[model samples]
Target chain A: MIVDSLPRTTLTEIAGMAGGGAALPALAARLNIVEMTQAAEDAVLQPKDAGRWPHALRAALAARIARQNDCPALADRYAGMAGADMAVADPAVAGEAEGLTLVCRFMDKVSVSPRDVAARDILELQEAGVSDADIVRLCELNAFVSYQVRVIAGLRLMAESVA
Target chain B: MNDVIHKFTRNVPDWRPRVTPVKLEDATPEQLDALQVTPSNTKVSAYVLTLAHDVETLKVRSPLFNGIMYDPGGLDRAARELSALAASVLSRCVYCAAVHAARHAQLSKSTEVTDDLFANGDKADLTPRDRAIFDLAYGLAGSPPAATPDQMRAARDAGLSDAEIVDAILSSALFGWANRLMHVLGDPVRKGAA
Candidate 1:
């Protein structure tokens, strides 16, 4: 499980800042935010009710997003949770074998070019028979992964600066 | 027909969800808890209702969002708003941009910064500090997160303390999360049009 790999220290494992005590002080002041961030990661990646997307699929998507953002360590951590759905973690796979080509395309667009997304994108999903609830679930997963990627990137920069 | 707003504005736009929102009457106990709906606070926006479909994330996301954007100290409110606005602009999340821009203008007590931003985008003329903050946020909001050590140094040189810089990262990164849901799940249309 993704939660199993989480470090006890706030923002340390996710941001790959272990042994760097410099950024700890700044992070300690906002410990609530840090803790809540972990809670959010759990909620999105492995929610009690995962809706249409299972935990393994969510982890694959999370790993894919992390790679898209060039965060290999974070990607590797999530990849461990991907189980049998690991091929979906590669951006070049296109998800055809998994019957998720459309889903993959939608996620790629939303992740890299959200501004270009429009009503038609949702329409296509609807036409493909994806439920409204499932659509929301997919988006929450994609959105949370996007947020996590940037936070990891930012935290690394913070650690580097203070180091 | 109500027009979908394509340009950046301080006038907040209404968000119309493409998916069916969870009806309040049909909401499960868990969804109600996530929505935080009390009798006195029964009113909820369409956006919130749409998000109620994924109650787990909604539950934790709300508190984390508030802590990053509204917690005392760290980055000043206006600076945090600026970081949010920068991310919104980069993602072209019109609804998020307008709302944060308005908040930024209100907090700063002037439209000068948002006005310049709306008119010129990344080339908007800003005070050195605002420039550094905006640039850092814009870079961090990119798909691969283009923020570099130089931008971090620029923010420091612009007088932002470490705490303030961390706040900027959180606010901007929070919007990176927000923009996908807002821009991808719905359309930003004129008020009452949907």
Candidate 2:
């Protein structure tokens, strides 16, 4: 697929893979993966059935994860999509006012120190009245952003190598 | 009840979800479709059923996962498994590490690499090639992604093609997605054994 037509949120665009930026010939072999990645971003960030988490909140969380990964460009993009939840895009802003203090803590731990997450973490969420399904929804959002941030970072490193 | 496995091991352990999995009988049409619950294939793992709560992401992720890992002709299967293991180990996702480590051993037809990995971790003794691949994947798996141009050069110097390097990135990044789900949503345990 042509790079121009690719979604702006895609790694191809976010990592500057187009226009002589990391456009390795091998990338063509995985066009399907690229496209599916955009589709995944949509599914996670703006799904038709967003469950308890609104699209804006998901976008804020996505930005927060991107920032934690130090991908400012990607974080900026997600922050733009956050709308009213934009404050939460800043990792420093605890989501307490938004009634998301536990959610934010859970997301931060899962994103930065996943190894330390334990059964008690899930128990805390459940105790706070977060449903089982909402917990799953939060995880999918956090997990997808983690994947996206790494891919963009990897692509940028690839670009730098070729440059 | 079962004891959660704290340390990494090559033997794949049972995954126990901290949250309740969606009951098969109560699944909606969309959840059922995403789960691919055919009459012939009714047995879904708790991990997958738990994911069915967000069927939209689950649907797209399943295919993207298979395409990255199982699609032919980029990085070799064993090498892809190695990348996956690198990410899982860094994330400390015991379930993911075990499954991918076993696959790496099976595909490479040797346990030496995984055994060393489980023993020495990031300091695992490896060939120049495996070291380059593991280092790249491990760096990429970090929160701030520490992989540098030098590491990319090392991979090329180790004789990895651009295609292989891309595959390494994808396989490792894919686990960045998988590890959070498996490690956060559940525990790896010895089923039926305390």
* Winning candidate number (lDDT): 2
Can you write out model 1's per-residue Cα lDDT over A53-90, one digit (the tens) per residue? 99999999989888998988888888999999999999
Highest DockQ scorer: 2
Query: How do the residues B1-194 of candidate 1 rate in per-residue lDDT, one tens digit apiece?
Result: 34888999998988889999999999999999999999999999999999999999999999999999999988899999999999999999999999999999999999999999999999999999999999999999998899999998888899988778889999999999999999999888998886
Instruction: Judge the docking of candidate 2 as incorrect, acceptable, medium or high.
Output: medium
Off by over 4 Å in 1: A1-10
Candidate 2 lDDT tens digits, B77-182 = 9999999999999999999999999999999999999999999999999999999999999999997789988999999899998889989999999999999999
TM-score for all models, in order of appearance: 0.96, 0.96
Scored against the native two-chain complex, candidate 1 gets a DockQ of 0.74
Q: CA shift at B8, candidate 1, in angstroms?
A: 0.6
In candidate 2, clashing pairs total: 0
